[model samples]
Target: MKEYKYTINGTKYEVAVGDIEENIVTVTVNGEEYKVEMEKEAEPEKKKPVLGKPAAAAASTSDEPATNKAAVNKNNAVKAPLPGVITDIKVAVGDEVQVGDTIVVLEAMKMANNLQAEKAGKVTAVCVKIGESVMEDDALVVIE
Candidate 1:
């Protein structure tokens, strides 16, 4: 058996992975039992070589950390307030949203909580999908 730590919102759970050949995994979250499917890992694909000035230019820009800083500065990332399973996602990428708009619905402690936007802006990215568990302070969306 292998131990794994999963966090949703800010809460943490310790889970054990067992019976890989049977494709079954038993997880206890917050004292509740959950049966999960164990999928086989796939091999990584080979990377293809890029040739041309454009590729060189892209590679050069990627080598600089300034590009990363700029990307982070371009959007205001919203974080999860607590560990929970995402019940719904109300907004999509490129969607214009307003302050107080429901961005995601999370189920925690058997209660459904709506996560609203903090400010009015266009949604640039969504980090979590419906039915996915998220940890506290994890990026939920990016607004620009």
Candidate 2:
């Protein structure tokens, strides 16, 4: 049950909304109860979670060996935001980087996207290079 207060013209009413059977709702005002029929059926509200995505790097598996680079990574990993080919790699292992620094450039949807760092850290590994194609959330760089 939900409680609400409404004012109509110069009159105030305290309402407690209760269970509904079809289009009618059980409501009480003060000490009186009433069954109100809704002209239009009510619909329940729905909500969904939203998440932010980052840019992706473009690359071809032939250009960079994914197996060798990502063989081991630190706790924090920078992932590709979208599926695309790795067009350019901006950082290498052992390089210190700051937030907003372009870690790689991914060519997705025929557009070149610069994938930036979300936090300041050292690049622990480089997972992909130029001409390599990567999928969404693919490991691009591991940061520590």
Task: Indicate which candidate wins on TM-score.
Answer: 2
Q: Model 1, range 83-122, lDDT digits (tens) per residue?
A: 9977777887789999999998887887888999999998
Each candidate's TM vs. the true structure? 0.49, 0.52
Please state the error at residue 40 of candidate 1 in Å.
Answer: 32
For candidate 2, lDDT tens digit of each residue in 19-134? 89888999999758999998884578773321111223223424455565647563577888899977777898899999999998888997889989999988877876666678
Error of 1 at 144 (Å): 1.0
Instruction: Tell me each candidate's RMSD, in Å, in order.
Output: 18.3, 11.4
Name the candidate that leads on lDDT.
2
- Which sections of candidate 1 miss by over 4 Å? 1-75
